[model samples]
Target chain A: MAGVAEFTKFPSESLKVGKGFKLAEVDPDTTPGYPGNKADGEALLEELDDKLAELQEKLFAESKFGGTKRVLLILQGMDTAGKGGIVKHVLGAMDPQGVQFKSFKAPTPEERAYDFLWRIEREVPGAGMLGVFDRSHYEDVLIHRVHRWADPKEIERRYKAINEFEARQVAVGTKVIKVMLHISNDEQKERLLARLDNPAKHWKYNTEDLKQRAFWDDYMAAYQAAFDATNTDHAPWYVVPASKKWYARIAVQQLLLEGLGEFDLEWPKAEFDVEAERRLVERS
Target chain B: MAGVAEFTKFPSESLKVGKGFKLAEVDPDTTPGYPGNKADGEALLEELDDKLAELQEKLFAESKFGGTKRVLLILQGMDTAGKGGIVKHVLGAMDPQGVQFKSFKAPTPEERAYDFLWRIEREVPGAGMLGVFDRSHYEDVLIHRVHRWADPKEIERRYKAINEFEARQVAVGTKVIKVMLHISNDEQKERLLARLDNPAKHWKYNTEDLKQRAFWDDYMAAYQAAFDATNTDHAPWYVVPASKKWYARIAVQQLLLEGLGEFDLEWPKAEFDVEAERRLVERS
Candidate 1:
């Protein structure tokens, strides 16, 4: 992914968690790409919400005008990584119909028996719709590697598989935006404890978060390896800080908006005679 | 079919095209139910557009809060009857993801071997969606009856089948809104000629529309008969005047708005800690 040209619309230096990336050196609390404070971010998001919504509609309406384009946004992070918050806040700004969201959980016996990518292939959005994966096959490399569920050799093979899979999707007109929400262990500990303190949040509290915290170093190493192996020019991975919740939310939304901004979609021309239809209306 | 109580929100006498109705006696240019002029009707529609859109979001979001609901909008009309116009102007105002539209054409050879209702059963929208049928199986009773493609005995049987089919849909939580756009013969001529004159509209000016125009009287008789036989309490029909283009467009929007208005939908409750999450944001 080195020697890549800069994106026409993605000019922000703060959010470019891309190639030559190393996980340990990056600060979890730094808003590297954001220019505004939380209040300014909130105001920016308020304006973006409508722009993103209208862009989605334009993307959808384009297919009727003989344009075939699709988008797949892959979101990967650890427990309480603000993945759900991104969906509820950043991606939720549009008509729910325009986007399809899936949170991939542990594989069933049937799923595991097949290739790991087999379960994900069919779920990609069809042309003209946006598909969001809250947790993706990156889990296979991240969790699977950290827990030693797969040997290093096998984990490396899956990384290559993911790279090839996304390249093929790009070849078929699907734009892939992969994001990893980076948060410090300290922030995660507070989030986990908050879930335990509140009865209403009991449903979100998973004891596995505590167990996984013990292997934090191994998980970080796994994420670094996965990023090096799979981050490609075709579908690059972006890491955004999650400690500042509102900043992370708006940054991710900006990433998606800038990505779609390159497409140059426009209002589809009416297929009928405008003057004639107007005359008909006027006569009536 | 006859004993059901009146619709709670459907109190307009102008929009009713029900059983025991005769086509010739009804004025094609009158707006009996509307309490406004053309400009006022246009303003009302502008208001209803946003109301209908929000209602659709509530309907789609309801199942997350433990409610299951679906809507099927069935539109039947003659050539240049403004069926497509209503879909483009009215249904187009909302998020397209929540609405599914199908313009049913002639049945394929594969579809012809099965019963008429078989093709339709599979197309009904699932829970939490709005399905719009630009043309529905009511064609079986209308054109099929008018052209004598089916014997009167079979036609009679199909009517009974339609009632059972719609009742099943209603029983399973799909609200069916049936509308017939009624336009005068003079208006039809003007529309057909307008299509002929405009090169841009040539694609829409079907030669079949000319063939069907010869059988206009028979088609009217077919429509009258179809209304009497199949206008059930579960899925009644509305005949909105289409001579005035804006009037018909707004009227159909009102009908669908009123149909979904009765649904008791609310914002789906968050399964997580609303209070704690708010606190977490505030702290951040």
Candidate 2:
């Protein structure tokens, strides 16, 4: 029954981005917050499942009965930085019904016609849901900035717009947990090569991923620029080390557990007369 | 390592609705296909998780590579028949990313404005997704029939419309597995009473659910009529005995496995040349 904080060597606060936070200094290979090896980390994750599921159900129940609070887990990472893996392992632990999962690929023609946040705003989780964005609005800032798809002024505007958008979300009771999964260039290369080496994994081996690899430094700098602009107290970013897949998964899981714990979620009080309902059921 | 078929005393085929299927005759307390006790069913569910996950990923992968095949699991039953439990335990075993879960409640103003199928068609899973409807278009027939919300002619028309809609879905590689989680009225009363007894479960208790109980026989007859009309080779109904919670979970899990198995799903062949991608990764 050890709490997530007890299992982690580094508290979640230590992983939080603060003033003068630099993404470059993070060691993607290091298991930040958690001191456990793979086996230990996996065990801790399994242990946290029940607590996490209960907390999530409480949030979902609260939403059903007029609670507006919802958590948005925004994952921003380079290719092979394990964004999808975090989703599969962390958010996967909760009821799929409770999790509003959306993976943003390149914008479609209809999406491109609208403002960037238009598509995003439409997908925000309603009260009592866990909203997950697998490569979300941050893409506008990251890829849009890297490819110079937008003018420098427009790109700068997007950062401000994103901050305000998130602030509005917070004002309306959203707990935004933005995570940047940091992985080394060498690790990315190894993963890409590994995918190529296996036929079964070939479907995941995107040629564009290699093309994007050439711009590794640009993406990092773009991410850093993004973190500097949009990391607010209302919606802070957590820089998770992703060189070790196990560490990345566990850290995100703990971050989510910590996020849900903040709600101090209690199951909503019975709205009906319990005794009367019991009588009604018995008579039926 | 046993296949799902071996664990079940009754195969999924027997559970599937055929000509002259009688909802009244179905013993909700009996574990039709599954012979094992609760503990064994739980164990088997745990064992099937890995294979189920693998098959689902393959289906998802296929969708990414231009495969249009998808599976839609339609869950319909009276209140407290454990629809939510099936979702939590069965579909939950797979990656949430691959499962498109939707719970259809009473239609909204906008939904009521459109044809019932309009709201439904919008939520149908895209290629390679496992779409789940907690309660579906069948509500139009069941509730509508019980209350005469729609005239007899209109209700009859809806049955034809639903069959045609499902036929369209199947024509385009959608495998529709409609399941009615059959729980006896007695079992439902016990569940409702149990919910009322627990403070934590208060949010789940709806006064309307008890009111629905009075119309139980009408609902059952309506379901039988609907089944007799709509059960087709392409999209059929499965009546699962849901009084035993563990039995329902494992049976749905097996149905899903069998549905996915029909695809003979294989990993998509690498679209890119292997040597070329390997060299690119090596150079990067």
Candidate 3:
């Protein structure tokens, strides 16, 4: 906690969405509260790594004992917006055992047969674990709205369902951090071109991405509408300017650090009689 | 693949168990084929990091396309023999998304009702993923034998069941690397004492570990019996020297490297027309 103050300048509060916040107005290239360049941002991330790992271990310890607190980081964005990058660079700093990661693809026929949130509810991180959702239930709204896969009336009902669902998560001690990696249209085009140019990166290129890019504006409008309905103090949305990958990595790491720091995490007391156990171990 | 030859001295072939291998013959303090001190071993691990990460991502990419190959690393040892350490220092180097890890504990009533492999079969890693088991079905034989919880006749049946189960996994494209983190009684004592001294580590200490310690000789014999019964070329067992933590880490890392490198993993060819997709992205 000693060196954590340096990152307080770009507190999660600055990136949080409030009433009437417009997604179109956010500059995808802006580094927001971070004043440093790429090198400096990377250095800060390296410094924050130990703190994040320590807190995560403590949270894991708490869960094994009597603590019920856990975290779920939901990443929502268009393809090539750096969701996978953040998973590798930011959350990757913690031990794999402490992190529960799930990447949602197209739902199976069985999943579609249930309520939209049914599959999502099953993947929630248990007490003391850090759960990460690469593409989450938000897709049901974001992609569904953009493609008109569901009627407008049904889509409207989903926003309220999402809010209530998230509130219940908060009530159960899960600190949900929902993030939209905001990258410009031009940035995405550049990324896609870079993927196409490298033979090694060909596996990452999906033709569906082009179809999604065609409806970028529609997706943005859907995002804003969903934000207006679902953004609450219990589980607020953070729009990370992801054009500079370094800044987004550090920002997400800091947000998680701040979330874990809120809990007064101390080691649990020994459950058994220490002296008796000590004598037994000494003799053995 | 260039510098990988440097580690050929400790190729997994050297550690693989054959008929009549004895657990007591292994010196937990020895570094086996690793011709290096602690600092040298640590440095080598750092150098191997990028190579391991690259191979893992290729495996993941292959899974998404059409590869069925996968790996499962099983770790078994007396308490405090560095199973968790190997996971943090070695498997932690790969992308967390590509590595699927599960730590088995005492089975619940639900788990006990089915055949022993019921829960284990459910957790096997899918295509192109690296699966790790902190403790596994081997426990059914090891602890059950030491405790006499299962009669001798029942215990004999489980060894054949485990071999058949693993052979099936190998036939279906899983390269199972089973390892026993061999640590001495002195090392276990020191580690247990260290845990008792640190409040933060108290949760990891269990009265059961001490109870299990009282049966060290019995447990060793039980392990040897298991090795004699179930060791097969399809799923080989390696005895990793656990006293020197750095040596164990590097050895396990090398074992996994060789496992993944056998696949001839080239970047997956583009599934769609690359030039056409490039043009579509450019115009979008």
TM-scores of all models?
Answer: 0.63, 0.98, 0.97
- Candidates arranged by lDDT, highest first: 3, 2, 1
lDDT of each: 0.77, 0.89, 0.89
Interface-residue RMSD per candidate?
8.8, 0.9, 1.1
Instruction: Compose the digit string of candidate 2's lDDT tens values, residues B109-202.
Output: 9999999899999999999999999999999999999999999999989999999999999999999999999999889888998888888899
Ten-residue region with minimum lDDT total, candidate 3 chain B: B1-10
What does the lDDT read for residue A276 in candidate 2? 76
Instruction: Name model 1 segments beyond 4 Å from true.
Output: A1-17, A22-68, A73-120, A123-161, A179-230, A238-284, B1-14, B23-32, B36-62, B75-120, B129-135, B139-158, B181-225, B241-284
TM-score of 1: 0.63
Better of 1 and 2 by TM-score: 2
lDDT of 2 by residue, A9-84 (tens): 5447878998998888888888765656787878877888888889999999999889999999999898888988
Model 1 local distance difference test score: 0.77
True contacts kept of each: 0.00, 0.79, 0.67
| Among all candidates shown, the one with the greatest lDDT | 3
How displaced is residue B220 in candidate 1, in Å?
5.1
**Model 3, runs deviating above 4 Å:** A1-5, B1-8
Q: Model 2: residues >4 Å from true position, as ranges? A: A2-5, A8-11, B2-5, B8-10
- For residues B1-284, write the lDDT of model 3, one tens digit per residue: 33332453764876777888999998999887777788778888988998999999998999888788899999999999999988888988888888899999999999999999999999999998999999999999999999899999999999999999999999988999999999999999889888999998998888889988989999999999999988988888998888989889998998989888988888899999989888888888
